[model samples]
Target: MEKTNNKHPKGLPYLFFTEMWERFGYYLILGIFVLYMIDPKDTGGLGFLDKTADDIFGTFIALTYLTPFLGGFLADRVLGYVKAIYIGGVLMAAGYIGVGLFQEMPLFYASLGLVILGNGFFKPSISTLLGNLYSEEPYKANKDAGYNIFYMGINIGALVCNFVAAYMRNKYGWGPAFITAGVGMLVGLVIFSVGMKHIRSANILKPAQEGDTKLSTVLLKVFVPAIVAGLIGWIIPGNIFGSDSTDAFIFACIPVVFFYVNLYIRANAEDKRPIGALLAIFAVSLMFWAVFKQNGTALTRWANYYTDRTAPAVLEKPLETLYLVEEKSYESKEVPIYDDQYRAEKNEAGETVKQEGKDIYFRNVTPERKAELEADPTKPVYLFNTELFQSVNPFWVIALTPVVVGFFMMLRRRGKEPSTPSKIVLGLFISALSCLVMVGAVWAGGNGLEKVSSWWLIAAYGVITVGELCLSPMGLSLVSKLSPPRLTALMMGGFFLSTSIGNKLSGVLASLWYGYEDKANFFWVNFGLLLLATGLGLSILKGLNKVMKEKGVQ
Candidate 1:
């Protein structure tokens, strides 16, 4: 055990800044992405008619998550974590900046590809590096605390970016915001380069196990086949699964998922059980992310188009007079008030079209305001930017972290603190409850025709942040606790793989944004999904508790 007062690795500071800036860049991009895509075609956005935007959003994030499998494998067997991080950072910066300069589809796709590939290289390796730092004798005792600290740094970067995004978008426009993301990444890369000396000890590449695929062989076997299969899937004749893109992505992911399963099977005896359990946890965790990540896509859509974000007259005067907030005309002209069910579009044959007026926000905005905004041409409505609400979750993360850490420490003193698995289960259930609050918001708004107060979003975020505080940090802690000493870094990648999947699935869920007619039904779906995942976790709780006991972690 580490001495009671031993400090964390000297490398942590370097990793912390590097990660913080990287996330700053990423969140900045994510914060504005959908907004940019869906903005008016006249103003340089894709103007992808809502459904198309959702599909692209889902596909991009999913592929973004899916690439880490290759990234992790290569780092474990070929390039050390440090080199991988550098390569990833550079690629991401280039990609982010490149996106800002182009409105055309080809450049857009290329930039996204760059970001995905960069993340594959950068995301998993850094976490592995940090895991390596804490695995040693002097810092062992403080591993969980160290990770919490690192996670906080991530939140710090995430929280601050929205403000930067807001200021850039509000003052300059969308391009600056994209360019800003790239610059943030570049800053992170510079920080990492400066700190290389402190982290070299933690950057060692592992020797492959006897059955492990050679790096070159994996490229030939897994990647080449995946590419060929994906090409065919993309080129297939019919829309087998709604879209050719979706079909291709699913096909591509199949081989990667199977490869991971094979890894668990091929693992040495000591590693097998832990791998199984991690994979299990990863499965449940996907549900959490699918719901949690909506804060950006669906939830942001709600904040933008539905929620009563109007600033009070008194508050509005200073803000507008100070030139900090924008006041846009709100005749609710975005959609017609007369169409029953607020349907925005219809087919000429009098057939009811499915895609019209399905913007996620319309479910929450009431009929009265729709008419009012449409009728009143004189009143200029000053509302807070919808992207601003994106900060709420991370804001709570910063506020609640100390309290959560304190609460757990109290339980530890009483010999009643929960195991990591138990905390995760509890977190999932609490998360379900957060969605129920949105259900209440639906009820209060009279099933979403009426605009509700901002408190609904506020309360939902508050509740979910509690769940996030419990589950997210603990997942990282569990990885550190359970990983075999020999495979610590590889397993850290595995942990992030779960996060990557969940993150992508979040996009998938968000992409389905136009599918739900009633806002309440949409939230209810989220509620049910969380409850389902929670029940699964609870069922396995006893076994997980046993595993933790075996691992000798509290």
Candidate 2:
């Protein structure tokens, strides 16, 4: 209810920058995580097989999202949002630094555990705090625009961090690059501390109501059962979901899923409809993330091995000067031999087999380049860093945010703006089309027999980024609008619960990349999944709109 002429709250800019720096760190790590995992051990990587790496990547992201369930609960019931954010930020910083310093698997996993735990504490609290800030006055009507602006801040960080990660990794090696993530996180924490005065009023903690579940009971009922089920899933005789981790994750999710369902079942009459609507939206949106989150896994694989990464002649020298290009020489040495699909050849013992040959990058090169490379074997080919492609989605987000916001504003002025749920459904439909772009990429590249232009990847990311803009931030705003005041953060956790499952599924889908003989089919599957999600959203659109109208929110 504080008035300001800035058209937004005083706290918005502070939260925006705080989240920007935090995402800078998170996205930086994500941009390079899979590449690091699959790189050879000699290069200071885990040297995991692509499938194994995909599994770990999926599980790691899944756990990070999953922990928000407890984090939100604790923030709502015990710790205030500000304290939780500080704790989370420090822990994440330590984790990033630890990852840089350690190489042993156990230590590395421990470091990731720190990040997972830290993100749980950090992620939900910040968004919830921002929502609380918009709970009153003229600000209330502007929640969607506020979240859109905040989302742009997130992408600004995302867009720039990949370049920094590329420069750091290319110049200083993986350790320093990982360590830089920690530095970024610390910087974010510093910003948060500086802006604490501006935002502290928004960090209100609601007192428990009579029917509210106690934290102790939740721990006993939800956490304990989830752990037990996960353990059982892990130790089962045979794999049910293609891997122990997958099985464990799916099994663990059962209890948590049931808990959310139970929350709906037990909700008071007034709270039930809105909670139900949020849950419905959560279920449908999971498919969108299942496809979109693949930018880190399957899509990165396309950029790394399938796309033509040759720097344009005009910019090659400048890129090289900046250390933004990765150079591979045509040296005939004992390196991993890849098949047409770019899978490393493995011996019967499951170890990669190497033979004296040109690098895998040459496998799908044009005939002219192949002859030229063979004639001058010592020549190095300078190409853009594969991780640089990770920036494309964020770049699209930043470039398009203003357009999207303006378009919606125009519609709002004309009394024709779609509700948030409608936008989300439209997003799913558009995101499904991004898969078609990749399918075209597969066709254009002649089914992996040749390298495709990088433009294909860029265009695909462009389309998906549009869908992401419509859905992701809107989901956050929708939660703020519909949630019962005390349960806002908890419902936000439910949104992320959908994201966790989708992330894990993204990994599962990526792991199957090698199994697809015709890569177009892979993208087609993604398209089908999104279509299903879009249809589901449409089916429930009326009911969801009704709930929104009843709640007196758009």
Candidate 3:
């Protein structure tokens, strides 16, 4: 045990800063991504339907996570971790910049592709490199705490980015906001390069071990099949999963999932149990992410349209000074309202088409509020930026991480620390309750007919934040602890694969929001899925714990 609570390696600080800045850029773009997509094209947005935006968002995030598999594999055998990190950083920066400079659909998708590929290379490599640093003595004893600290750095970026996003998008436009994301990414790359010497020792590439799965075999078996499966999904008769994108994504995941399963099946005897434990934990954890990842989708919706955004004048002016307020002017001119697809039924020639209406947000506002707005065309309403709410979950993470880490350290000192498996189980249960908190928010809002207090969103994020602290960092620590030395990065990729699946699933669920008139039921379904995962996690605890003990990980 870390009796003296020794200082972490110098490299830890460098990794922390690199990850912090990278996430700053990432979350900044993500905070406004769907909003930008669904916003009117004339207003500097993509002009996609809400469902379409959700699908793209889900696919983007999922693919971003999915690329880590290739990244990790290449890092282990071809490119060293540091080289991979640098490449990934540059690509992501360029991708962010591309999105800002281009407005065409093809260009927009290409930018997203750049991000996905870049994230694959960057994410797992840096994480594995961090674990490598902790693998040495003294730091080994504090691996979990180190991961918690590293995780805190991620939230720091996440917390700050939304404020920047809100300000940029509010003051300038969509392009400037996206450009800022690219700038942040470049800054991150600079920091990582500057700190290269400190992390150099941990970037050593591992040669293939006897009986290891060769890259050639994996390409033929997994990559080729995944591409074929995606094609099959795209060409299938109708929408089996509500959309072609969703169908393709799910189908593509099959081979990847099977690849992971194949890992366990092919493992040598000594590695089998730990691999099994990881797989099982990965399965249950998918539910946590399915619900948690909604911060970018369904929760964003609530913040945008349902929650009360009007700030008191005193607070409003100060917030505006900080560029944290979005001001909307009331105009006297009447515009055709848009249908669900955001199309007007009548053409300029007065031809028949889809129905149209005012902006959905204004249409949903109370009649009294509408009249008050209509009374003064020149008046501006200062509302808290919806993206500002994205910071809440990360804020909670920063606030609670220290407490969670300290609590566990105290437990360890008393020889009473709960095993990682136990912590994960508790996290699953706590996460389920966060869904219920949102259910209450829907109830308080009277099924979205009226605006509700902002505290409802805050409370839900707060509850879920606690669950996240227990789960996410621990999962990283678990992989670091349990992975076979040579397979560490690959296994980390597997963990992210599970995350990719959950992110896609989150998108699927969020896309269904418009279909649910009773919003509470949507949250209730989220609650039930989490509860189910929690139960499954509980059932597997004994076995997972046993494996951890066998591996001497806890």
Candidate 4:
């Protein structure tokens, strides 16, 4: 019954905070995931090769998004949104905790599977639930703004989680850091439970319509075919996409992609144009994610090895005291000798060969500091934790959301606001510019021969954040506005399916990091991908705008 200034439903703030904490848990794990995987086993990490870690990271994220296809379908027909969310939250919480408690490979994979399955049920349902809240009088016109507001909550959680993760991991080690993520998820569930009463009205379930596809048919046709194709891709492939998991994932997606196409084909006449428009948007936006999602892989690698993370003098003491800084002492000891690309030398047995060597961080250090460290080998250099860079994109999101929201409002008042599809096309172009910034960074840093300022990474994330603000929330809002009432959740899953495919491609690209002798070319490839997406989006913009207008929604 309560409301925010009587402008929105009371449930808005509840859902906002619930998502905030959930993302806190989610991003915390992501910020540390790759670092944990590649860390030496003696330091409580998985000790996997960089290629191996990138492959798993991509597969894990890809599957997380992929599962929503089933999750959303079930929420529409069987479990309902609220029940699905509860089950998902619980599963994710247990998964987070399980990851911390078990380090063996089998147990570790089992835990990740839990998190992937849990995310499937949780992600789409919550977004759909918010759309339902804004479907009625007093709130209908504000749905886009509502999604933007909701999106900021997600960024807020993402913005702050890395610092907590740094403090936890640095102070208590990796296991405790992961456990903190589990605790955050439980807190989110509590908040969601407390606001359940206020949001109950939005939980109305639409019955299956006369022409709706049967659940049995989808299981047999989509799910079964996907499973079979994935197995075939896994067993009969010879690195078609660089790894068995990548091949399996790509093969598995064919059936799901076809399912979405079939959904458009089967839609009633009234819904056909809108569904078709949405499919086009999904296809284009996949490239945006293919480049943007690199924050967890390629960008993270840049932050870890290429960026100069030295804590400034004023902040160094406090950061070290709080355990937010990593210390590396130049000790003369048996250590892995790294090549110019930072990969360790391996013997014929494929084991990393240790010899008297400096830490990899020294490779890009200034000569003066390197000499000073050599003079006092016991003295340690304090640098910010690599995981801290994960917060940059989210920080930009939180800081810029209001500015973006206000800018759109100003345009609205002038009766000149861009349509959602127009904004998305503009977003793709802007995102491509961010890639150019990194190319500049690569040149400025002498192609990783020297460390670059942290500002390069920050500036890149800032630009992409602007594009993200324009595209991501609009994509969600568009689906809600355009999808048939009975099919909203399923369509939301389609949006994420695009993101899943993009995420997998990101991993595939990142796995080729060592293959690029000229790192600038790496970023150039990203720029080209975004530019291609921009061109595709522009080509279809007018048609999509017409569809939106025909649907009587923006």
The per-model lDDT (C-alpha) reads: 0.77, 0.89, 0.83, 0.87
Between prediction 1 and prediction 4, which has the larger TM-score?
Answer: 4
Tens digits of lDDT, candidate 1, 244-324:
776776676577567668878998887887777777887898799889987778887777765787778787776565423
Number of the candidate with higher lDDT, 1 or 4: 4
TM-score of 2: 0.93
- As for candidate 4, its clashing pairs are none
Q: What is the TM-score of each candidate against the true structure?
A: 0.85, 0.93, 0.90, 0.93
For candidate 4, what is the total of clashing residue pairs?
Answer: 0
Which portions of model 3 show Cα errors greater than 4 Å?
1-6, 133-145, 266-270, 329-332, 335-379, 413-415
lDDT by residue (tens digit), candidate 3, 315-382: 87778878757656665344545554223334433332333334345655666788887888577678
Query: Which is superior by TM-score, 1 or 2?
Result: 2
Tell me the deviation in Å of residue 520 in model 4: 0.2
How many pairs of residues collide in each model?
Answer: 5, 0, 6, 0
User: Candidate 2: which stretches are off by over 4 Å?
Assistant: 1-12, 132-146, 268-270, 345-352, 371-377
Best by lDDT: 2
Instruction: Kindly indicate the candidate among 3 and 4 with the higher TM-score.
Output: 4
The residue-by-residue lDDT of candidate 2 on 1-554, one tens digit each, is 46776668888888898889889988989999999887766656767788988999999988998898898888877898999999999999999998888978899999999999999899889988898889888788888678878888898999889989988998888989999999999998888888887789899998778756678877988889999999999999999999999999999989989999999999999999999999999999999989998999999999998898888788888888885677888887778867666767655444567888877887888777678778988877788898899899989988888888899999999999999999999999999999999999999888988889899999999999889989997888799899998677578778988999999999999999988999999999999999999999999999999999998889
